[model samples]
Target: MDAWVSHAGIFSATIKFNEPLQVAWVNTSGDQVTPGSFSLDPLKVKSKRAYINQTVPFTIADEAAFSAFTSAMITQPNFTWHLTSDKLDVRALAFPTAHGLHFKKDVTLNGMNNFGRARLARRLQAARDDPAGGIVFSATTGLDNSSAFNVNLGTGSGANTVIKPGSNAVTLDGRLVPQTGTDALATTFELFTKYLNGEQADVVATGKSSIQADGRAVSWLSAGLTALELHVPFVAPGGAVSPIKAITIGDMSLEFSTHAPWAPVSNSRTVLAAMELPFGFGLEIEEISNRGRCRACQLDG
Candidate 1:
């Protein structure tokens, strides 16, 4: 049996993903001169030769997770091109049109609550009365009949969620864009190598990431990737709401984990198991590392 878990009030915040797409060029016959890569002439022949011919063109793809119900998407800190098309044609600009581009996404909290609470009062009651007296709780959620704790909560409108009462208004503001071709990736790699060097591979940039590879070497110049940065926001209850207190049945304490998987679409095949707190619980977010997995939990006193 499952217990009813409800949010005392609305949760809201803005989540930013600073995932930067990088490009790097390797395996060059010459000294491997990058766009702005050069050394001072011994004789001081040319102060700045501007070896712009050796540069490449690329773009980065940045994305944010936003509410699907939003009527419009907002672009924060819009990106601009510093070099003109004429500069690109004449090779006056080192990056030119061939330079790399990076696109990012950010999601804002716009809904009162991300999800509604689920109640398991009936199931728990049934389990308590069962003659066998064998009731165990499991976090794994799926449709398999073999599991004892496989509670079916229904689908679509019938699906259970964590609902908050007050301030029913909120929104998740973020961006989503497609990034293709090797040109952009290559350039991105180059920038990455220059900024951090080979010794610092774990240095995370501004955004969360999830990069996938085609199973082939991207370049001998850089490391291969499967997927990078898939970040979600940490939620905290706001507005008028009572603090959630731990629920207890007899001497046994009731608790659940809140760091659950987030899949925005309702019809998607993937299953979600949210960490549910007792009714009137408040939300809080803990800062975590930007790279790899970014997870948070909902707790009660």
Candidate 2:
């Protein structure tokens, strides 16, 4: 016969960011996560029965975890949340409140062939014919019939490229218009082209390529447990050690608070620097497996 054992006590927690080439993990401190601080929110409806299942809440451990959590929030970077107990391990992904666009290379005209190919060819031919004459190329911003940015290549292709918010506008010459700032479609084509070419003009005039979260916001948390391991000790009737069984939780959500750093603050003061805003997140579990083995039986065999 095998006797079961119970594991119930305080556990350790760790949080880590999954970034390219570098991963950061922070341990919880007493100041960050207080004792008996874990909780789940109750779902409520105006005229219906309330659901008691929703988001879980917990405080960060200390100044270090708080600082790290703050950084992750502002940067909108990806991170992993972990909770470890004597017999269980829980984990989840904490999504960012905001994200920005990043362009890896410069935009050029040679790549576009649909709209301006013939007109550009005519301009080049005309320029060659009159050595003293130069091709006139100009661009402006305005709403098209569809209320999108009207991008004219100034060529006689009779084709107009329209740009919408959160979408890229490709010119007749293969230039990529960035989808950044509040009103990117209002930006002049000349400035838009220059900015994509790595020119440092007034970003305000061209529109910002990135923006941070102004206040507390929430984002999606995805795929929960990357790995989970549990250890359960078993005892035999004769007081001898029996097989040890390992159990794992397949799915769970790990939610917590995270602050967006909209303004800069001095890091010298630990308390002031460690403040974090509220946020919630959850991660889905992929799979779960278990196994049991008896050392005493193995030795006897």
Candidate 3:
């Protein structure tokens, strides 16, 4: 039972694939950036098994198809990946034949837990029960990404994450991104070279982010919480029951890792910006380089 997941609340689903799949692509090999060796022809894909909500084995019956899929991943310099689009060539996805099942019966979580708390007992029993064919969780989500990165330095210990007292954590977080520089950013392989040579990668984002969002139609939402911040209901008061119709946060990018012994950025004497609201216009105020909001909520007035 293979599963797929994302930054979404956990849920269980049972799906029945009542049809076969079809897919097509163009493949270009060798040193020359020429036409695809494989034509863009839709090929049929047969399901060996379609047991939803379970960890089932799915195989690509066609040998070349399987190889093409596997070769799709050209990983970055480190064990990292950027949620950027310019990465994959859609030309390879010339066309696709989906075995899209009747999505009606699928168990969706929107109506789920709206009442709160999945009983602990049922959760435990679900874990212990047999006939509980393992589960495969996958969801289709339209994605629009600007920039993202995954940096794994091959060092995995609580100590690697330890930010020396008073020292900035971003200076040590085993990763870096350049806001401005002439040198081409290092690749995953090149990043590894730096790690071996004790070189530095710009990891720290120096200033607080600026944002303006229409909560009603926000295209993206990302946030973080350092040791200094906590999860709280952050909403604007539009007259007692304010609907923060929109929101924005420190810049738009979010750092995947936070919480270390870094300096308290909020404590910095440097005043970045100062703005005052004329009383009842509700909103949130935060410090730079520190954890702010991590989750967005849909406020229903």
The lDDT for every candidate, in the order shown, is 0.22, 0.25, 0.24
Where does model 2 exceed 4 Å of error? 1-37, 40-53, 73-77, 85-301
Pick by lDDT: which candidate is best?
Answer: 2
TM-score per candidate, chains pooled:
0.14, 0.18, 0.16
Model 3's TM-score against the true structure:
0.16
Task: Say which prediction, candidate 1 or candidate 2, comes out ahead on TM-score.
Answer: 2
* Candidate 1 wrong stretches, greater than 4 Å: 1-32, 35-210, 216-301
- Tell me the tens digit of each residue's lDDT in model 1 across 124-204: 111122233322221111111111111111121222211233312122122212225698667545533432332212222
Q: Each candidate: RMSD to true structure?
A: 28.7, 38.2, 26.9
Residue 246 lDDT in model 2?
40
Rank all candidate structures by their lDDT, best first, as comma-separated numbers.
Answer: 2, 3, 1
lDDT tens readout by residue for model 2, 1-301: 0111122113322222121111123323412221222332212222222223333444444444444443332222223333222212222223332222221211111111111111111111101122333222222222112211122222222243333322232322212233456566556554434433434333211111111133221211101101111111111112222222342334433222235222222222111112221111121348533332222221132
